[model samples]
Target: MSAAAVPEWLAAEVAALSGAARAGRLPHALLIHEAPGAGGDWLAHFAAQLALCERAAEAPCGSCTACRRVLAWQHPDLTRVAPLEDSRQIRIEQLRDLAAELALTSHAGGYKVGILTPATR
Candidate 1:
């Protein structure tokens, strides 16, 4: 279970987020606002993986047990909230579920990340 090599764009973001995490300055809730096809969701998912990765490095090592799960999209600590089929908006119920997941402890002794994508109408 190793993390994949973080993309350059994602690496930069992780560097910033990692600083915040180290300083205990990260917000409890994160809202990623971006236009369609902007790879906004990808950014969110990469950030989530960095938060959960167990490898030791300035960035994710992509070789730790936790990293592997993240790369495989099986990390229990990462949650993505998006619209359902036939739906045009993200409902409060889905937000609640994300909140619940975030409230729990990380399985790998790391932070749990709830990635909220672009808000729909």
Candidate 2:
């Protein structure tokens, strides 16, 4: 996708996050919080893509293989953990599983992103 996919209001945040990734200063994990409809999901997706982008200089470039996989939820380096409706809460098992996965090597040998959503559900 083009830069148009990211809203103008989140431009600064994305830029800063992208800069961090580019500078190798990005943390292993990040927590994104926002009120409902505040685009937390979108921002997390964007940041995840940036963190995993091979060519971060042109992140979410819409052409790289890594970007494509992330956009399609097929990126091996990206792990999304959200509370299931049945559970309605992030169980200890979920965190433990994520930790185990993070211990392994990434498919792309790059950043491994674990996106935990509905953290309070």
Candidate 3:
């Protein structure tokens, strides 16, 4: 989604994240909390796009190949962690695997982003 498409309620948070990214001061990890349908997942993906965008200067341009890949959930550098099928909670093995993946070098030689959804689970 384009920056303009971000919900107005989330705009300030997005701007802060963007500024941090541009300044090279973004945290190594972030926690995004949301109510049921609050677009938390979208914001998380946007954060990943900001870090993985090919165009660093205009990151999350929301149109670059990297951004497109992210939007499609096809980016090599983006790893999504969620509960297994029929499971209500993420298994420890899944988190271990996530750790292993993050330990490896990024495929694009840029940032590697892992998003853990339903963190409360």
Candidate number of the best lDDT: 3
Model 3 Cα lDDT, one tens digit per residue, 4-96 = 688899988999999999999878999898897898988898899999999998888888999999988899999999998989898899999
Candidate 2's TM-score reads: 0.90
Better of 1 and 3 by lDDT: 3
Q: Which structure is stronger by TM-score: 2 or 3? A: 3
Query: Evaluated with TM-score, which candidate comes out highest?
Result: 3
List clashing residue pairs in candidate 2: none
How well is each residue in 44-100 modelled by candidate 2, as lDDT tens digits?
Answer: 888878877777678767778887888788999888888867977888998999999
Candidate 1 lDDT tens digits, 1-121 = 1235445555666667767766757666566666776666666665665567665453355667666676677888877677888777788999999888888887767788766655656
TM-scores of the candidates are 0.71, 0.90, 0.96
Scored by lDDT, model 3 comes in at 0.91
- Once fitted onto the true fold, the runs of candidate 2 whose alpha carbons sit more than 4 angstroms away are none
Worst 10-residue lDDT window, candidate 1? 1-10
Model 3 scores a TM of: 0.96
What's the lDDT for residue 22 in model 3? 91
Question: How far off is residue 16 in model 2, in Å?
Answer: 0.8
Badly placed stretches (over 4 Å) of model 3 are: none
Clashing pairs for model 1 are 1-68, 2-67, 2-68, 3-62, 3-67
